[model samples]
Target: MPNPSDYIALGSQSEEETEPELEEDSEETEEEQQEEGFIPVMESPRVLAEKESKNGEATVCSNAGESGENSQGNEWNRGDIDGLFCPICMEAWTTTGDHHVCCLPCGHIFGFSCIRKWLQQQGTTKKCPQCNRKCTLKDVRKLFASRVVAIDGESQKRIQSLEAKCISLDKKNAALIKKEAEWKKKEAEWKKREALLQRELHQLKEKTIYLEHLLDVKPRTLGHPPSMGGYCVPSLGSEFNGQGPFILQKELGVDGARLFDIDASSKIILMTRRLQGLGGMHVLTKMSLVAPYTRQDISLPTGSKAVRDLHICPSDGSLSLFASLGKKLSVLSTKINNFILAYDLPAPAWSCSWDLNGSHQIYAGLQNGSLVVFDMRQTARPLEFVNGLTSNPVHTIYSLHNSTLPSGVTAVLSASSAGICQWNFGGSEERQPVVLETGNQGACISLAYCPSSDDIIASFRPRIDNSNEMAYSQHLLTPAIGQGVQGSHVHLKRFGSNCYQKLAVTCANVNDVRLPRSAVMNIESHGCLFASGDELTGELVLQELPSFTVIQHLKLRKQPIYDIKYVHDVDGGLLGCLCDDILQLYGNHALK
Candidate 1:
């Protein structure tokens, strides 16, 4: 290891003395060179010269002297010296010191003292120590600054790219923040709307509770009077020794009662009545048949508005089926006093009935002139639907258990405004209904069926003249003997051999100026008796069946009678007559 000072002194000696010293310096290992903090120049001067000449421009070294002098007039600071060093000593260059910053004509930078000493020791040739270019002491230029800085073109381009990337990232971040704010605003609005809806729901529930309470307490003052002035007389042809069979037992006044059904096993009558505050909504009222006759009002499920028809299940006394104007057929459990099953219907239902043949089948008569059949075992949908002969509403339906029909055939009798139709099922693959011919009495308004007698009684309204020619061409036409009568007609017929044979027909003063009225028939040991409301005298008329002969007249109010039901059990016979204002119960005097 030779001393660094000896190498610097050897540069000024004779050529023969310096040649061996130069070889020794060149033989130093790369590790030694790096340890000395010396960086080798990558580009040769010849290559730089060719590149400059091709561009038709002088080398940067040629302009260094002029640039140095021009820079003296501008302000100089320490910041201008970033990343600048002298190539000869590998040390930082200063502004005003013995080893100040300077550049040779070859554009190579060094300390001023280092370059001057290098040129003097090179004798008269005075070549550049870096590029071997001939130069004198006057060719050396001094930089006028407190510090020196070198501009790296590649590093400056890299920093510009990084700055542009940072700007793009900032824009993306701002967009994400804005989106987050918008989502938060939407969430708050939804929460507010939810709170409002919850408040509305609570208010509706309170209103429902109040309305229910009003219905229960408001009708207590309307209790039935002790008597409604009813009387019974002996039948003209009966074998009762000139005494009537039935007498009034009690009267129950249920305000707003529309329809009712009696379950003998449970000894309760289920009736439908409108709510006080909510007139359009109707619910069930259960009344006990015993003394004191305790009553309970039951609220129906939502959407079951006005019930059109109600009936107790013949097979299961605890279950009752009803049709509603709400376009639903619902089965309610009287034991639990709640709706157990419901079915969607296409149109409002007018009547419903259970199969009296001890099957799981049930039937619904729709207002659209269609009959829907359902099996209690399958609740998802109806078993089948049959379209009626006319589009008029089927107001009455009954399941027939006649022994005269075929063994495999099951029959259902339904009556509408058009006529009476017997629907037969299970006999053949294609079962079609047959319309019963009853000599065209009038529009069938109501129907009643007796299982023991296999008899059907249908009431009719006077026929209306719908022909256009008759109204325009009539000059003087005498009406038939009973054609111009204002009252309705009642017909008794037997159903057998897939047809109806007329048994009796009589003019009745009932259902004349009113809507359809219901009638009932009861089986007695002597004979079967039929009862209906007589609008002319405002009385209940009891007539012997198959003859339509009047037996007894029980006086009632002038109000219309909407429904009647009769059932006989171990407790003898019970008769329930529902009028607009009161419900009257009659019992068989002979059986009691």
Candidate 2:
């Protein structure tokens, strides 16, 4: 009848216990003394728990310390955390790591794997499993060091060596510098090809899902159905509850979320791309923040359409779409060509993805210091980016590619008004930046990761609070204004979540002026399908990620367009789109 989490809260609430709970806590003989006079020490999480970005009053206990006071070993890492040696067995992890590791909440180290069974047999209360300091997370590790491991282990020297190797490996990678020029050209070409292929492939799949209409119809034969539960039942030739003579309805639409062509059996993790705007540094507008509303007259030929940011479902490669037409985030789905949500944004959002944990649902980074994490389970209002930002707005987010790092360890390494800062999950540690050089500094605008090669591509610029639309670039830096820099120093942070920290940065491009925040948003990882936009001109630019010189000039389509979608239906194996709202269905036998 009781809630389990409530039990976890209660069970975990041993900041201190009654002398009464003592017999219940017999494990602590020394804890009795500490409880009377010991000061608190810092005890870090064995691994940080899953937490929301927001923080509030914690479950306060009487022992809560005042501000600025550090807990025991809170200043860990200065000395090896695994330095203390066990006086009982006198070695690093006397037996197995599990037989005796540290317990969180109250940092006492113990071999409960042994004491637990010992306690059960005697029907005794567990005091301090170690020195019984009446365990609180703050003093636990210290108690363990003082009691469990009175003598230091030989691990100190080994730890120092390991730490040194880790520090050295963090450097040694100049491969990014060598590949810079080639990567620039290759990125440009791939952009075009990826855009076209992703669009076309998406459309083709959509057509197949609804293509049953393309088949010749045959009349149905109906007989007694399951209606005659216990009796003989006649079968119907119709795919529905019918007989040979009746008509039936064809299949349409999908289940859950939207009109998705997703496979219920799919197990792959899909990575979708969607955004509201882009940011750059500009003399006209100190911070070049551009979204759906900031349009310009670039003087395009007739029929040159602008493509909006796309909504893709990475789970099954199925996609829904959203674009801006009359200054709103339009929802492009199979049911409607443009189901527009009449909403306005401070600046259009640039890009978004599922945070590594898949806990917060989606994290969307806007042009300024405005990143938002939307709970996938709830779409009412997103947890705005500014709420979690301490330094600057998150410009772009990269999914950390690592198996060594735990989930939610790395997040949107924001390129804000100031510099780069990682939005660590909850109150963890801050991420170090491998930002662009000083002169070439501003907010980062875009991010793309090449799985083929281990490179995360990004773009940057300056602040964008005051923006002017047309003829904006001509404005010069005022004597006292336009503090934003050109930012020739955008570098890629490699293995950001690795234990062996690695850094890879981009080369100087003093003259590579980043364009004003535009719709040019997505970077496809599978070597094809790129999407960019001219937000001001309403032109959607689609291309493919190419590798070879010959593959360079490809586009998802030759003509500029406004929106697109990609889907794979149950019947239609794979489909992609360029501009069509309806799916032109076909059979598997039909060749493209």
Candidate 3:
């Protein structure tokens, strides 16, 4: 609240006031004169002189009004002043403490406590009491009396001391605001640390479960002359004598081979390739299946190098091959008049496959940890390039043709030294792949898909140091030549999301010179029958898919085997074996 002397100066319209000037203004206001004949009046000069003459205990008094007002002969009282009451509390600023005047930036004054309470209740925004203009607490100024009645020296000292305390309280408030900011920063860091620990704990739990699974005893391996009694296993029938002429007249041998059945025409296609000497040759041979056990080779355009992988479309008899010399991919249709389309790859492609949904798309995994997909309609450029597991070379690939997954998501599984990884293709270019782990198995060597169960089967080579034992193995081979107890066992795994379950660990029928990479494994059309070639013993190891139980172990070829394939036709199952430059065909004798 402003001092009474300040209000007197405002009403007089001057910096200082005299008793006679205030008396003249009251007489000129004829309207106010008619109402009371006398308004509040300032103190006379004689009264001030008399008060100074007395002790400081002398009190200054005005006799014109008892209401809260200044002695200015002006409308300062509630009865005379207009808009002096607080709009929020509907009360006049009559009390000295609770109803102290607060002035806002808009030059409007109201009771301090009433406006403070109204602003706190609203919280977000506040308005001045008189003008209803937007305002805040910082925009308000608390008015304190600049002068008061003269008192004794001791009373005057007490008022000065109270003013000093208000300054100290303001400093304390600033320090508290800074302290609150520092504490909030620490809280955020602690929350981040807690989240990091939770992720680590989850990963540790997964590893513990995987280690326990590995500790389970290895499955018993079946050895010696395995029997074929209960299982529906196919074998070498009498039609094949294991004495077929070498493919390509033995002049040029095959580096890669694949068998494809043209389901539309009930005919099969046999594709092979061989490389020439210094000139960097590429010879792709397409054989036609005319009879049940006979095929005639038809030559196609040789590109740059030997084909590293060959695949033919089942829906359309389109032959695709990836060569090694220039890292080129070539596509040739069954029609002789069509031109051979070729696309250059950034790296050497080791495996290729066609899309399952007949989208005219082809995918090939390269040696540089990349999978390039090509749209057959546009053979001039690749459609997309995807990364694989780490930087390891991708050796095998299988297209997931299941309808269980969401649409627009094309998934492809590939195997490399780093492990098996699945790529989910969508819109983004920097898409990350999901890694498949199966305990502590060695590098992934092969990947196959089971259409019946929609499961993926993978083969891993057990980690062992053959570097120092090379000499001992060469010498022990003479006595253990026919002994089926080879230490090398192929580990089989079923792949899932970020994990794989061990299915079987069995010893393949092979000799010292043959490794697991040299043998070929394939799943039948129905996914129930699995077949693999044992190059060392020249035998076909037939097993049940996923379970990997040996159904039959039939000795077919006399020399090293190169590849093995299973075909479904009018006959139940026909087995094709590529060995020592020869291609032999066999089937169940029941079909004959």
Candidate 4:
């Protein structure tokens, strides 16, 4: 009949007054309640609505008859009535019912009837079922509400912090995945490079082993003279048949001498010289190899320019053949001191040579890489005019007449910057020139041939890499006699079966100026000998053939030798070294 709050206060006061009797009969009542399963008597809906309206917490519904539906809808929508159930009985509690929701001082809530029974079962030691707080039936204060809602501010803040941390962790994970993918790509590239390098290393090892086998077997089969690590080891005594080293017999100082050739039969040397104040006229200076060393200057025709190459007739020493930049190939009779034969050429001639097998045959190399063959029998025109492999000037030409080659094969060996080629002009069928492989040994600037040994010596200038403009310019401007210049290479090769086989190589101070000439001569007492100029010391270096053993270094006047000639006769041997300013003659002591 009274209000819900007044009824709750009156029930609490009566329960406190009857507490002693309830405790004395608590065990028996608890057993009976457990068997029957305690059921709380729920209050009517009108009373609950009245209590909720008085507390100012009830929602206003349009229809009072739908009050029950509105309360259920509110509980479902607010989602705060979940904690309004009794813990022990697991059922919703009523605000004014016998099993009302109540709380201990420690804030644990349970049904009032459930707490009373729970404490009565514990006898004198009554404590809260949820928090173990010491309490009795009087301490259970009822909650006067239809529904309960709690707001925990710290729990809300903790949830927001956890969501932010999840977002940060997701971004970090994405970055880590991207970095792993990039590392995988880099690792694949490195693995590919490693495989390629391994293949190259294996190929190099095979090549090295093959070369080592050749080195061990080749020297034995070729009957090459024994050498100590690519160096000739000479015996203790004199290297030149106990005559001691060659001594300087005579030195003729001549200005403007460019190239020269020796006439062993006549004991004379013919050199090309430019006479000063003669309007750049070039002449032949003749000198005797004997004691007084007399010199005679013979003038050429007005149109005869500076001779680029000079060679005496091998069969007849009285005649000399020379190529001049005046576009003329002329033959001079040393006896008459005049040119008796001259052939007009299409281009400037660079080098000339006479066929040793046929005295009537002559060959001229031109600046335009053309070989002009002439027969003395017909002076009107050349017998054959052929182009070389390249347009570079043919700086050297040598007639090859060896019996070991196929019969009726007359080949002319020529060398230019394009490399060495052998032209066959005396076969039944015309054949193209064969290019002999010299194994990438730069530009072939000069060549020396030994007919008896079937050996050829080629001098090379360091190859100019066109990609490096500065280096190419330096190569062009560098002087021929400088010490620090990248010197040159001299390779010794044997000619057989229409091919050339490289035998040995040596370094020299050869340069690309004036077409310096080197010589290979066969001496019965000294085997074969090779002579070349050493621009570094301005000396003529003499070495034993094939082995390249240094026999002597004849000191000159510290000038680059333009030409070297070795002449051997019944009397003795004579070596001639021609420089820009002087001509040096060295002979054995017997001849000296």
Candidate 5:
């Protein structure tokens, strides 16, 4: 109907209305959770204005911005809010890329960078203008990032529109919920009447049957409205089993192989299930069934934007996904949809993974040689930034351990366009980053941390020094897995080690055989499997992973598989793939 944006306006209105109360409620719940053990997360703030006053600027660069051992850190800590206020806004706070903790004669903390940028525009400098005290801010504590403001009336208007749309969508959902409840009530009433009618008909039938016997006559027959319930022309007395549903994941990234065959080693079965029905490029968390775990909508900013990567926290079962839009990285929550938070990035984020640090924090690595830690408790800023990384962008961010590490140290590794580096959380950003060069720097395409050894599996363009670096390139470009294995079987390569000294395969083009784009896909959680659909060909392929082996391929009434999944059902976990509007099931022979 009336356009989705209209409803979002209402959503924002509602969010704003209950924000204060929600914040208070959150505070209370946070305290109670502390007794149990939980962490908090995220950022982005409101834009506002204050009465005019004075402007002050703080800049840390050249000698001051140099990386070194932590010198005079926190020495600049001032008391409560004071002189850091902008004369224009008369507000004691402002925000900049660098989360500045400015020392003020009036004791305030705002964006040291934001204030400086504001001062440049005014073309004048005033001393302690807010407190009217002498300007004397000694040390500038620059722990976070620094940003240049590019905002004006246009951007503000755009933000307002998006906020409005979010609110409106929420209202529509609420109304739909109410409508569904009413429909259910009506259906129940109709069902009750139908039951009474059926009883009356049964009585009539019994009476009619007796009369027929007494009169030596035949009773009329009733029939079902034909064919929707199938009548298979089969070899008599034979039974047929239909296909079921299942979950499917595309791959484990370029780092390793998909979960299907396990490199054909002595197979190990840790907890696993293929998530099905995820065909779209974007992976988001929409609603939360578990309370205390905030439920949030996931929506991309309007236009042709797509998320870069997806990660599910094995700890809380929460999902964390990030999008690469511009220079800045937008942190997206699968739990929250319509609402989004922006985090200023030091560099374009190449890759990311979620790791539960100490049960309360989520450690996300960035392209900028550091691990960005988001404390779920405080949305104000990142709790810590673990330093020591390569100069190039960090290509991969992943976890080494599923559980908390011993000695209170968690092993987290990051791969950059240049090389790979590892770090623990308790470190300072002011030290020489422990850098490691993985022999060459030809853009690390993919990386994964092996749980067994501290070793990392990296897929990169081979070094020119190699005798047949050309051969290496060819191998990397090959299609590592495919569908033509058994009659309709898909084949996947098992996991391989990076040392090419371990495994190797190369092909001319992987995209040539690529299927039309899908919106969603899921894999069965049983052991390992992949859901496949070819809308152009009117085919659905359920392929096993790691082995590139196809288990089944079916030709349904040509429908675009928008999503595929393995669902846990009354019979057993089944393969559930969606095409167009209907869902078709493929049951495992065992389930039947």
Candidate 6:
């Protein structure tokens, strides 16, 4: 008999080949044979012939009588046959010879049905059941059992079919991989272009925004004089031996006109007292630079008392009009289209001005010789009040606010019948205000301090003045007991200097020297110009500061001028005058 191991060497021989049997056989002991459980069986002649008829195909079956034996002397069971049982189900794979043996690319073996079921359970992973290695059905090979064999011709045919299928699959896989790579490259290019377009759009938006800002700030052309309440009235330029640039353009009739202001946009606000009535009126005149001089009159509701001071906020074009009738102070708000009144004051507000430091704060001088500061942000009450000065009425309030002052110091220069003093609004209540160069300049009538420079222009009269030297007196003056000027004189003083210089004494008979009340009166803006009205001659003199040379002078209609303001705008300086019931605009048309 032949040993099947000699014929079934792994991949060594064809399925139909067999090894020749030996002439002699070794005898085994009965007890050892029983322990080995070697079984042998004889086959029927009809089965053997039928198996050989199929082109020499063969099936090696285990002999039942020789089964249940272990060659290693261990107990033999049905699970001991190599490659004959399903590793997944732990069942005999050859029960009906329906299940085939399968091998994975990882070299692990399992029943074909078992591995197939496991791969389907794993979905796309297709892991082998025995070794858990990743492999799909394409990577799996159907392995044949050593006992089952096909003839040579049929085995060659199966190999050729598998090789053709593998080549076709490889071609399809190469095409898909190349297509995926191309799609990724195109997506990257598209994203890059999209980012570039976004940057361009952002730059365009920024440039558009910058152009809009330039349009807002750029000064437009003032093609013609503004449309006035009246036609153009030629200025009397050579009346007082004056040959300067300013010239009168329009002369309007505004009765009892006291306080007037012109904003940067040429908008004019005139505060005047009703000649025969109890209340006063505010005439808001909007003057457009680029005109046919545009003028639209908006008269606000009048108050019982005469409006003394008018202030227009530079930050916002809000109007603040102070009335001397009572403690009433009205704020004309164009934004809200109404007036805000603050009353119940201890004394009448004589003078008012906005903070020169470009804040929302306002300063007022009261008739009771007190100074009050108001924050327009919160109108409940004033932020600070300084009292206990001399009982003489506070006639002028000058906000000496500038960037050159020490930080945290908010001071104002106020003038009263007593003297000129500096009040620190940012200080405590107990701190006494410094009286800067105060003396016989009796009751400083008008005060102006330049925030950007050291120039301070103030006009005052002696306290012991004769009745003849009063503001409107036409009588001749007598030398009174006063260290300063007798009637009124303009003093230009530096910030840290003790001595004050008179304005060059350029003009004679100067009764009430005045400065422009507009907050825009810096040296650079208004060219250091101060104005004075001669009481006897009724001449309005415009003198430049430092070298107080006369710029221009206009003789009026024998009436005393109350105040004059320089219209601060791009078209040089325009002068506005209030004399009796007339409102005159000088240099309005010619400067442009």
- lDDT values of the candidates? 0.66, 0.32, 0.50, 0.67, 0.37, 0.53
Query: Model 6, residue 232: displacement in angstroms?
Result: 22
Q: List model 1 lDDT by residue over 1-592, tens digit each.
A: 1111111100112334322211122344434533664232244566456545656322122222234346566642433322244556645444344565567665666777888778667665566665566666666787543223344565679999999999999999999999999999999999989856754463354345434534553453245322223434433524554556676666666666778888888889999876444444566888787745666667776786788888898878989898887888989888888888898999988888888886578899988789999988999888888898877778789988847777766778898878888897666568878877777677776788877676777887665678322222111111111222344445556656476677778887644323445555665675778888776677888887777777677776436676788888887888888776478787776565
Index of the highest-TM-score prediction: 1
lDDT (10s digit) by residue, model 2, range 1-592: 1111111111122435523332233354544543665343343342112111213112111122221135342433413333233223323232223344345344434332443333333332334443443333232332222123233334667888898987776654455565786899999999989855754454344345334322322222124322211111133223223321111222211101111122223311111211112121110000001111111111111221222233443432232333221223222222222232323335444444544434334555554446555554555665443543432334345444334455545445544345444454433555544443334444454444433233443445444556432122211111111223343323243453532122333322221223322111122222333333332233332332231111111112112221222233353322222222221111211111
Candidate 3 lDDT by residue in tens digits, 1-592: 2222322111111223212211111122333323543222344566456545654223112222333344454455543333344545655542235565556765566677787667556544455544556666555565543222233344558877777777777778878888989889988999888855653453344345433432321121122112221122344322123211111111112333332223224455455534223142334444444522233334444443545556566456655444343577667665662336777888866677777766577788886788988888986688888766466666667677636545565777787755777786655445678776555555455555654445555554443464322222221101223323233234344434234455556555444332222222333332354556553555666665556665566554235554555444564445566655445554443333
> What TM-score would each prediction reach against the true structure?
0.58, 0.30, 0.48, 0.56, 0.32, 0.49
What does candidate 5's lDDT look like per residue over 1-592, in tens digits? 1111111111011222322211111223323433653122123222112111113122322122122114434332222112323333433332333333343433333445554444334332323323333332222233222322223455589999999999999999999999999999999999989955754463354345434432331111123211111222223113223322322211111111111101011111111111122333222323221222221223344431334333444443333345342333444433333334555555444445555444455555554455676655677777776553444445456555634433444555666545555555543333333344444324343453334333333444333343331222222112332322111211212123111122222111111121221111223343344444542345665433344344445544324333343433344544444443233344444343
> Where is model 2 poorest over a 10-residue stretch in terms of lDDT?
281-290
TM-score of 1: 0.58
TM-score of 4: 0.56
Worst 10 residues of 4 by lDDT: 3-12
- The worst-scoring run of ten residues by lDDT in candidate 3 lies at 243-252
Best lDDT among the predictions, by candidate number = 4
Clashes of 4: 0
Candidates sorted by lDDT, best first: 4, 1, 6, 3, 5, 2
If ranked by TM-score, best first, what sequence of candidates would result?
Answer: 1, 4, 6, 3, 5, 2
Q: After superposition, how far is residue 240 of candidate 5 from its true place, in Å?
A: 19
Any runs in candidate 2 off by more than 4 Å, and if so which? 1-308, 316-348, 356-360, 379-384, 387-396, 407-410, 413-421, 427-445, 451-454, 459-493, 496-592
What's model 5's lDDT at 84? Answer: 28
RMSD of each candidate? 15.2, 37.2, 26.2, 26.5, 36.8, 23.1
Clashes of each: 1, 102, 1, 0, 104, 13
Q: Write the number of the candidate with greater TM-score, choosing between 3 and 5.
A: 3
Please give, for residues 49-142, the per-residue lDDT of candidate 6 as tens digits.
6545754434232331143344345554532343334558754443123344556676555556777667657754445554555566555566
Better of 3 and 4 by lDDT: 4
lDDT score, candidate 6, position 565: 66
Off by over 4 Å in 3: 1-266, 275-281, 291-303, 321-325, 337-339, 427-430, 464-501, 509-527, 588-592
Which stretches in model 6 have alpha-carbon errors above 4 Å? 1-242, 275-304, 321-323, 335-337, 341-343, 427-430, 438-443, 452-454, 465-486, 496-527, 588-592
